[model samples]
Target: MFGIGIPELIVILVIALLIFGPNKLPEIAKSIGKAFADFKKAADDVKSSIEHEITKIEEEGKKTEVDATAPAKGAVEDKEIKK
Candidate 1:
């Protein structure tokens, strides 16, 4: 799938069959599949974790912005009351 066409895939598979023989080929393919699955799972987990952290940071930034403005608003109200 990584840019290898059908002919290229066939050649690679033939070479693998010749080198590893039929008996071990399935086992090797199974292990490779599991490795790729594990890698994808890890990548997904990292992506989700980063997204969660970014969302948390954004929420905190919003909260801080609101908090920063609140005191100024209160001061303006106090000045209005004094006047």
Candidate 2:
């Protein structure tokens, strides 16, 4: 994929084999595959979280604003005594 042809992949694999030795090639390949999979999963999780937050903000915007005259129950009555 990404314009990488079969010959290019073969050359890359051959180089890896030379560097890591045949015995460790499979292990290295497995690790690489796992890393890519984990990266993709993490990216998806971040994307989903961002989308959820955006939806919550949009829903909040859609809600009707509260009327100011409604005295909230817990407000303190601070009537000032004039001297």
Candidate 3:
């Protein structure tokens, strides 16, 4: 993906083969995958936390709007009476 062609993949594999050798390659790949998985999990957690906060704020806003409008509706009649 990300513009990585077959040649690039082959080069990467050769580098890995040289550095880690064949025996430890599986362990190294597993560790790299686990690291990416952990990063995704953390990102998802933060996204959910932010979404929950936005929902809470939206609910509060609706309650406040209803409360504010109720008083205004009642006060409209009171103003007419005073006039």
Candidate 4:
């Protein structure tokens, strides 16, 4: 799935079988599956955390933009009244 196609996957599986033998293949596969699952969960957690931080930053930026423009908005009206 990670860009390795069917033939590459078959080759890898054959090598794993040769190295670990049939008796140990299931156990190894199970362990690999669990590790992959754990990795995916951790990645998702990190992504969510980063997304939450970005949202917080965006909210703060909007507030800053408003705060920055607020004084200028009033300054224009003050000068118009003087004229």
Q: Using TM-score, give the best candidate's number.
A: 1
| Model 4 lDDT tens row, 1-83 | 78999999999999999999999999999999999999999999999999999999999999999898776643666667888
Stretches of candidate 2 exceeding 4 Å from the true structure: 65-83
Q: Model 2's lDDT to the true fold? A: 0.87
Tens digit of per-residue lDDT, candidate 1, span 1-83:
89999999999999999999999999999999999999999999999999999999999999999998776643566567787
lDDT of 2 at 55: 96
Candidate 4 or 1, higher TM-score:
1
| lDDT value, residue 27 of candidate 3 | 98
TM-score of 3: 0.83
Local accuracy of candidate 3 as per-residue lDDT tens digits, 13-59: 99999999999999999999999999999999999999999999999
- Per-prediction backbone clash count: 0, 0, 0, 0
lDDT of each: 0.94, 0.87, 0.94, 0.94
Q: Estimate each model's TM-score.
A: 0.86, 0.74, 0.83, 0.69
Q: Give the poorly placed runs of model 3, Cα more than 4 Å off.
A: 72-83
What is candidate 2's lDDT per residue for 1-83, written digit by digit as tens?
A: 99999999999999999999999999999999999999999999999999999999887766633435556687756663332
Structure candidate 1, residue pairs in collision:
none
TM-score of 4: 0.69
Ranking by TM-score: 1, 3, 2, 4
Ranking by lDDT: 1, 4, 3, 2
Model 3 residue 44 CA deviation in Å: 0.5
Which residue runs of candidate 4 sit more than 4 Å off their true CA positions? 71-83
